[model samples]
Target: MPKNRYRNKEVKFFVTGHEMEMIDKKAAIAELDRSKYLRKMALEGYIIKQDFSQVEQLVYEVNKIGNNINQVARRANEVEYVSLDDIKYLKKQLEGIYGQIEKFYDGG
Candidate 1:
């Protein structure tokens, strides 16, 4: 709250209940009063960002798992599976690991 910034105009907008709850949680984690945090973000274009180093690590681990699967499958264009059940099981396991890399990749 800087007085030199000039007068503060109040503005209101509709938000979903879930969004409101998330705002409250974020403000609590930052130890900021809800209104103050909201106002600061609104006026300053500031946002709270999550630390994604752990997420990057998770992505790395998942990618290793996918590579291991590919290697075990002989790195072929087609997968060799004797049974539908086995393919289904493998797909389920890999689904959880998919897109995790994209989440943490900054596209550098």
Candidate 2:
């Protein structure tokens, strides 16, 4: 911890056990001690809360698409057969993922 150059004020608050646990978790993720984390959050006037469910779902879909492509490739290698429909479907899926990512970044 660095010495506070202008230590002239103090702030205090009370929180329940659950709230404290949440604070600890957030602070840990932010790589800051609890007091510093709270001070930065208080002064910054904004906090970013991420919902990763959509991202996780997107990753899952991408993985599935990749697996399908792999299977298609293996089949193509075994026999000289490749489906244009599957390639088109993969393109559409990728486009959908791109749109979803754009929406997410746009605060949808």
Candidate 3:
């Protein structure tokens, strides 16, 4: 075992069955043991819950844009020409998607 460096003080508490269940659920989601999770919360006062649904949605939107771009490319290849307005519209759509991603990063 490694030597302990900090103080040896201890704290104890009790909670109802419902509370313990909630604790277990939270710890499971964080993929942390109960003791470590509780210690982190006690020290940090709160935990930022992980939620990736927004990221998934963003990826979905990007995939849709890619599909649209592919279709436009296929049409242009078949016809051997692409209009200036179509190109400009595609550029504007890409810029709007970029702005949406920026807003997500900025937490706006």
Candidate 4:
């Protein structure tokens, strides 16, 4: 990055193809084009040009994992006699991991 890259205050980041696919998938899931979604996030500072040094990023990852587990549970519930108990157990395990993630930010 050049010293002047931040002069205009908007910088371009080059992501790998695999990372681009993830961004595309997220944009599709959010029902917006990538640029539009990114602009909205930047304006709201939800995905913006702030520093992460003060906060733990794993908390964000844990929240995302919790969301994924909920989605999986929803899908599991749609099936008949497919070990809901085991699914519940798995969700608990994810929650445990989530707890650890939170603990990382909790001064532990």
Candidate 5:
């Protein structure tokens, strides 16, 4: 045990062969060690696994938009002129992204 460890108590229990197999499978599914899995299940009765695919997609979209905005900025610098319609379109795109972020936070 590490000196900085806070868990000082030891727990012992017995399980049938079948029960042990089930526990191992469940622990593997949760991607946790048996000790942590058992402790969490015993204390919290359940575990929540969060999925971030939507967040990943959001980041991808934001990056693409950022790239587009940078291209527009580069063009404006080269020409010394920026179209108002282009600015409006970029603003609309940004607003749509913000709406998605709001929806994510609001659990919509």
Candidate 6:
């Protein structure tokens, strides 16, 4: 009654206690379970792990900038005037964003 069963074969193996501990550590780092980690290692012989916390923070900063810009635009529309200080503030925010992007790409 199964629609798809691509992985129908099972391979069983055994390892020592220290080897299991190392496998558990690596699986934790990769955010995968032991079975998936073993399958990936067996199939590809390697695993690539990446941290995106900085990128997530960058996205949060960009969202805050967008909100600030929207507020400035709304205020300008209401008063029909944009001040020099507002322009300077927006320019500074943009520069900060650019600096973050640069740092991210440069691996800093």
User: How many clashes in each candidate?
Assistant: 0, 0, 0, 0, 0, 0
- TM per prediction: 0.37, 0.54, 0.54, 0.33, 0.59, 0.62
Model 1 accuracy (lDDT, Cα): 0.71
Candidate 3 residue-pair clash tally:
0
lDDT of each: 0.71, 0.86, 0.85, 0.71, 0.91, 0.93
Weakest lDDT window of 10 consecutive positions for candidate 6: 1-10
- Compose the digit string of candidate 6's lDDT tens values, residues 8-83: 7879889999999999999999999999999999998966799899999999999999999999999999999989
Off by over 4 Å in 3: 1-46
Off by over 4 Å in 4: 1-11, 45-108
Q: Write the per-residue lDDT of candidate 3 for residues 1-108, one digit (tens) a residue.
A: 335947456778999999999999999999999988888889986668977777887888788889878988998999988888878878887898898789889886
Each candidate: RMSD:
10.5, 8.5, 9.5, 14.4, 12.1, 12.8
Candidate 1: list runs displaced more than 4 Å: 1-8, 45-107
Residues 1-108, candidate 1: write the lDDT tens digits. Answer: 576666566578988999999999989998999888888778776667878776777867777777766665773446544456656766776775655555546542
- Pairwise TM-score winner, candidates 2 and 6: 6
TM-score of 5: 0.59
Better of 1 and 6 by lDDT: 6
* Tens-digit per-residue lDDT, 1-108, candidate 2: 346657657788999999999999999999999999999999885867988988887788788878978988898898989889978887888888788888878877
Ranking by lDDT: 6, 5, 2, 3, 1, 4
lDDT of 6 at 53: 94
Q: Please, what's the RMSD in Å of model 4? A: 14.4
